[model samples]
Target: MPFAPEKPARLTRRRALAGGAAALGAPLVTVFAPVSTGAEDQLAIRSDILNVEAMQIAFDEDFSTLDVSAWGPGTRWIAHTPWSGDFGGARFANPGERSPFRIVDGNLRIEARRDPEGEWQSGLLASVDPDGNGFSQQYGYFEMRARLPEGPGVWPAFWLIGKDRSTATAEIDIFEFYGDKPDGYSSVVHVWHRDGRHYSRFHRNAVFVEARPDAFHTYGVKVDPDWIRFYFDREFVWKTETQPEHRQPLYILLNLALVDGPTRDATPDPSHMIVDYVRAYRLD
Candidate 1:
């Protein structure tokens, strides 16, 4: 439980910074190629398998109402990870009157702020609870549309982990945004074997890209038998070979966490990530 897809600071952050916006100009026509001969932008669906557009929405949460419980049997979401591994600087609080989540208009706002005693508290929502009750799928397209909170000490992310942990944990971090680095975020895939033998330093992956401030954008990933592809606003960014360890169904998780950083850059008094939706899709 201690192992998670955090920053990967020493191994990949520097490489990510150096990677820069290399994915800017080139058209990374991955799994599905946009083969438009002339005018309108359209894609030529390969004869092989599935594409994002051709998939059916299996789960959708617009946050119209909060159907969450601290831990659940019938609730739509749980307040903590199923493994009970709550990382980052702030405490992932349970759902209560003082909970750090709210529905503004139709969006879910995850807040991170200090308590009266100066301790930080924030929100985390997992699609599956400790008892393994909730939505999960073998392979699918998972996405979240949101605007992240900027500035130092804030850490927000959307990620996935395989359901069966009897042998290992297959984690795919869709995105991890560190406020200090406002222009980009991190995406890592980890295979945490029970013995810590497969959790190698070389397994950490990261990326850097442009994320305009205060604007809502889509962050997504497509998981298939061959590769795990990442996207920003539907634009292909990167991919990795699908790990064999990811054989079990995977669940969704998102959180607004704080980094225990320098005192000079204390967490914003009240910071939040406004997420418009969280949805998952399966091959139609």
Candidate 2:
């Protein structure tokens, strides 16, 4: 079953990046309104149709035990490859381990480090067989608190996958950042598989406030039938409303990748994407 590179996805990385300059800041981009009255702190619930419930948790060592159940049954733990080593590959780095994934000191630390073995690759961990996860949701609120890694070519992202990885039904990138651009983070929504490929339709919104790589910021996504919204530090940053396949069940994914091909940069010796907590919510 040879993969046909020609298959039309809802969007491709190239199409999304080509128009990157123009789409960097669209009106749809959410400008953080100063944290207002107490009412704003409440979950923005959709009227009558459904009552949205907020699932919340603060990560610490105790959480490691509870999260083990979230992965589902028969899931195998995938470790970073040896060639990549603990520092990751040429484009990315993870400290403590090659893939930057670990549980220690009461937190899930996704760190990158300079390749001790001189293998400067970054780390990546996905559901062994994402399709078999047997879990996907049509609409829900997803959130995570993490400390990002900064360095050139380090791409860290918390995103989603459709039942079929090859054909894109929809991909909701909650947050993606590069070490080069330290102050800003990006949020995008993608619907792949069409020929015209709505690549340019994908957007990138900025976080005007500084996001220090060492501190924890809550990154979130609120997905409903009509719209998908992104948030940082609990503030809205961007959204996509014209969802053609919003009803499909989309699974979750998180990874730190290096930019490939000719324009690659000097891989960071060691880098890490430390995630403090991840939570999912639904209508109560």
Candidate 3:
């Protein structure tokens, strides 16, 4: 489910009317075409692997504005996780003037810093709320292009959570970066039933790739019926068997978190994770 965004210098979002299909649970994509500003949407993901026309854009967020509201009826994003489980060393703060989210130069800056009360605060955005009022898809290509913050105790991630919680909770971690280990990141697939069942059969992959502090990089996952494929900067990196629990509509979440453990150096007072875009695509 997508809402059309204003055309900034970097990307253009054109909306198409979608009513009947939306009523039937199909959310239309706010179609996007790349602008000359940068390599934001220039990646050709599955042209050679699958039919080009088979995939259609489902969701797109260039973060022109932080469209968030309370965990109620009508917001595109909820500030915290739907289950009220706020993770990491830093607290996930509410959206406000002193909030961690800021739209700077057509990008979303998720800042990790201390509030006036001397408590650490950061940002997290989820596409779905507890009432199931936002966007979620069973299978698609989801991605985020971002410039990570580097320093001790800083943690950033882009991940997904299955919407149905009747039996189990499924998670697909696209990438989780620990600033303490700036040379690489990790991808994990997890499933845990309500009664603490089916937790061991999952994939935990550690990807070894050096990070350039000044440049932005892309991290993504293509979730199909049989496979969950990961990509770095449009280059395929890893894959695993898609779990049965993961075959349901899953919501998106991206955040800047602080590590819970101690580190050698001080955490950056005002660290930031600059996100260019978070998007999704579904194959026909």
Candidate 4:
């Protein structure tokens, strides 16, 4: 069972007489309000729905320090755009110094640039944790706020990968943006990958009413021991509860990639994913 985060209780002390002085000592104590149960603390998921509990500020400007130790180590750090196949002796940009992935003005900026070969090379931040933190978590909530760039062939996704290389435990995409079609974005979920194959069942076509390139919009997932719900800009857009696979706690991931998948085939120009924040929460 997943445990909730509770507030601390207030402290108190009674007065006592001093040995030498004929006076009572002042009672010194600190009081604290009880922390709320994870389920009790809610985020306005939508005008009609609410997320029972949600993580807050999981990653923000405060996380300016990048500790490679905190990240997974199995994955290789590659620079240059995403789609460009790794070639021999190609000089790559430094991962930590490139402007494509940087923190500025309280937001995370990741840009995708068009390479000389007319292929899109963009930023990608994936995990190396063989055992993601949440691989065992059956259910919880995930959320993110971001602004996507405008252009074609740009894929900005907030997703997760399973620790087991042999099979994908479960994958959830909070938001996926195809830069060319700036009016709408997608939210999807996948399950049970095996033998280099993956199956997906998801919901799509959630139009982002907010001017995507102009402002940041909130995206989230409300996962329970039994159910999973998705939201965009406080609106409950899609949900899934068909087959329950309450297995493990899955770690979190956020990245911006220039993909030429089924969504789009054009090479996007310099595009960006401006992330205001990323967060997650578990139920009490």
Candidate 5:
């Protein structure tokens, strides 16, 4: 449901070496262009190396084992709130009982709890499969190593979608964290059209963390073909080429929404978002 659309039009920035040189605190350079499509694919922005060697993993989940083969619990992720609903402010239960998902020890929590009639119940997971079969990929590097969950209507996320859900644009927001904006986070990339009209590219940083929003970091994205980087903890903060790209095959989504902004009422009933790992590479 957070696969937003409709509000896009001005976002063609692409020339950012981590937001105006990390807002004046400078000292982290290294650029290298060439990828306007003449294709020799260059883009090398080394703000002190973490380039992720070529790439090769191709899927690795360290949730210790709840690998429903590739994930698809929470009843394959159903929604309810506004239209397919669920853009936050609660409501998404279903995966048995008050399902809010869990995996414990190896991480992969997701909760948001409240119900007993007070109504909140959360948790969503998807990789396809619920009659839609599973797995999808196109350009990779996707990652996640969470541990977020502060309070105020928390809205943790890790996204990607486009295994063809009839087309809600092709999203890719590898991070969303909004527990009242502890330190900041948000990343997006949507490209839709089929008369629905859209084209987005976003990044809403504010990081300088010294840990504590639960701790564990690392959020990433590196879709290629025409670039779409964005990482944190591994540095290299943002990148985009934006267009109608995203050539099919994409599927992975994790949720913990409950937004209505301004603490949405000041969340905090059961809030969680742990994770701990979710990888995917391949591009070597």
Candidate 6:
């Protein structure tokens, strides 16, 4: 069956904290006035979303420094057509000196640019390192604060894959944004079997926002034994009971890709996806 992202509910201070805490199996602690008044108060609300009880900080990458120990550069990703065909136009390139991926001002920036030969080159980062050393978890809450790029042909995504890539692969897409659809993004889950079969589900939703795609927003997902939930900007967006039932650990992947879509011809020379942070928490 096909799936689409439902329109998100209007996020209120009370709802954001209370709902998120409940989802994490935690109790809400702070009480706020019906109408919040200052920047300090707003910051407090945001903090609660991250520090919910019954959850332990498993992995946190602020990108304050380019720590290759925690994240592997582009060499960890391979350049090939997605799904075994030459469909997507962009080629994933190995990391070089400021070529496609970089760290600046405490943020990790992944850019899609045209090479000197006029070929599309972009950045892809993975939790698995080139030496086959990396991090993965069975089930947890994963979140990323990022600002996406705008303009045609640009695609930025944060996703996870099972540790075993050879067969029966499991994947979870936290968020995928297309520049052409400036107001929405997609989330999906897939379980690919070794016999060339697959089970897939997806949700594409239009966000209610006044800012452009460049504005920073939080995208998150909670994976459990029987349920998978998604959130945008700390607000609950969607939930599903049909899960991948993945038993092995899963690793993270982030990329800025170019696809053959309506916006391809109009895509700008350089498009970027700026990431403020990526974090994971283990459920108690």
Best by lDDT: 1
Kindly report which residue stretches of model 2 are placed more than 4 angstroms away from their true locations once superposed: 1-73, 76-99, 113-117, 127-131, 164-167, 194-196, 261-267
Q: Model 1, range 137-217, lDDT digits (tens) per residue?
A: 988889999999987778888988888877666778788777777767777766655443333112212333444745898
lDDT of 6 by residue, 2-114 (tens): 12122212331112212223324443332111222335466444433433456898888888765442233343243322232222456667545545768888898877887
| Candidate 6 residue-wise lDDT at 20 | 28
lDDT of candidates 1 onward, in order:
0.72, 0.51, 0.71, 0.48, 0.62, 0.65
Q: What are the runs in model 3 whose C-alpha is more than 4 Å off?
A: 1-54, 198-214
lDDT of 4 by residue, 1-284 (tens): 00001111211000010111211333222221222223422443342285444433332323343322223344322232122222111122335544466677867677666457744455554433433432223356666788877765555677644344333345666777666666777665555433223344555554755455447777777676555677777677666552343245555556565443433344445666787766655564
lDDT per residue as tens, model 2, 82-101: 11221222333323334455
Deviation of model 4 at 226, angstroms: 1.4
Model 1, clash count?
A: 0
Q: Using Cα atoms with residue i matched to residue i, what is each candidate's TM-score against the true structure?
A: 0.79, 0.65, 0.78, 0.63, 0.31, 0.73
Clashes (backbone N, CA, C under 3 Å), per candidate, total 0, 34, 0, 21, 4, 1
The candidate with the higher lDDT, 2 or 4, is 2
Candidate 1: worst-modelled 10 consecutive residues by lDDT? 14-23
lDDT of 6 at 237: 68
Local distance difference test, candidate 6: 0.65
Which parts of model 1 are misplaced by more than 4 Å?
1-51, 199-213, 263-265
Clashes of 2: 34
Clashing pairs in 1: none
List, residue by residue over 1-284, the lDDT tens digit for candidate 5.
22322221222111111223322334433232332323333435442234577667866778775643223433323332111323456666755556677789878787887789886778766666644555568887788888888866677778876665344446777887777668877777765444334456566767736667688888888777777778787776767763444766777777777664345556878888888887878766
lDDT of model 5 at position 192? 45
* lDDT (tens digit, per residue) of candidate 3 on 171-203: 787877777667777766766554434332223
Better of 4 and 5 by lDDT: 5
